[model samples]
Target: MKLLILLLAPLFVVLPIYGYQSENLIDFKIKDQFDKVHEKSDFSDKIVVIVGSDREGSKYNDLWVKAILDSLEKNNTGKHVSFIGVADLSAVPFFMRGIVQGFFPSDTTKRILMDWDGEFAETYKFKEEHCNIAIFGKNEKFVSKYPVQKFENKIFEQILNDLRKLFSK
Candidate 1:
């Protein structure tokens, strides 16, 4: 009985546990098709442009989304931009490209955070649930939020201008 009690005591006792993972382990997370982990800390040192749109939006707004993706993928410009997707995790496995097809031409700054629950979007004040894009500064702070359905070239250009300012500083 003492032996059993001793054994059970260890089981019941709360002690330091090893190898626990964080739910928001942004660092070292693999992107869509790569053998790399997305590092969250990296954004602190660079400007990030995140896009989060899913479902029907991704289908109908493919062109516009692609344009954004293409812009991100441009030569030597990605270092200053990051994209975060706030969509269904299941869908991410299948349609990361559908959402990021053109936006990920390159990995210049590597600041993409895929927020499935829309927490980040909500915090950034984008409730349109369509083509939403936000820019985070080198301080790892959100500087702007732009929703797609209500966007004009001016807004996007303004976002670019904001990004340029971040770089300039």
Candidate 2:
């Protein structure tokens, strides 16, 4: 019994023990595909919509990313919110970074963050196969989170509804 307990102790220490912690965003920084730096300070006065996927092969993740961005664009909430799409590109070779960047247009309104180290995933305690969203309210504090299980029109409506409430507050 003592041997089993000792063996399991390491698992407890290394595994993610809790859900997303809001305090982690207080001093976070991430670089976008264009190599522009974005930090907590840049989003201080606005609601930041972070859509992220830690897994490199989840098709649903890609679909959700596009759906979220398109919905945000259609809603025209640019004045009050910032959109960040984080993709785990850590497995790509350093030399291929330029090629990966080329896939995106030079002037996209959406800020696509290249999470080359998967730091944001660890920080947010995000699941590898799902699209996770974190909304930071004004003053750079965490507001709410949405775990996207599937792509549907209802999810978009829910997001817009939440935004309206947040903006009203």
Candidate 3:
């Protein structure tokens, strides 16, 4: 029994991490700030960048969302890519949601997706108290995720390099 338990314990730890690594993005559907529905297929054949906070109070909104938007807009990647901002709106009171939604930037360059119930964040296993960014490759598989304490030029460089590699493949 001890031998069997020892063998199974490793499986318990490895399985969940394997599952998270193998999960694809096809199961999600999100709405843009303009209320347009975008499915995972919309990102097919393109590298996808998802930037947002999984937290309740929109923590680090300025650092994560704004900096990513600025970086993407300024960089000339020329590679096919889609930038989506995810905001968990379930934290706000219902009455003020409309007002809060209106405050999302109306930039034509990128689209912000509203996650009302935090389902998207939950699905991606994002930390609930900090901002993070996820990169999905052209194959629609999750590549990597980064938790941001701050955004700087180096982060932008890494993102662009990843996009280039994805574009090449």
Best by lDDT: 2
Colliding pairs, model 3: none
Count backbone clashes in candidate 1.
15
| lDDT by residue for model 2 (1-169), tens | 9999999998887666553465635475778867888776876778877787755434565676666567667877657887677887767789998887777557757567888877766677666667887777776666666777676788777877777777788
| 2-61: candidate 1 lDDT, tens digit per residue | 999988887555432322222231332335322234556745676766565555444324
TM-score, structure 3 vs. true: 0.68
Task: After superposing candidate 2 on the true structure, give the runs of residues whose Cα lies further than 4 Å from its correct spot.
Answer: 1-20, 55-77, 93-99
Off by over 4 Å in 1: 1-39, 60-76, 88-116
Per-model TM against the reference: 0.52, 0.69, 0.68
Candidate 2: 10-residue stretch with minimal lDDT: 17-26
What are the lDDT figures for the candidates, one per model? Answer: 0.54, 0.71, 0.70
The better candidate by lDDT, 1 or 3, is 3
What is candidate 3's lDDT per residue for 59-95, written digit by digit as tens?
A: 5656665665565667655446777678877677878
Candidate 1 is scored at a TM of 0.52
Model 1 local distance difference test score: 0.54
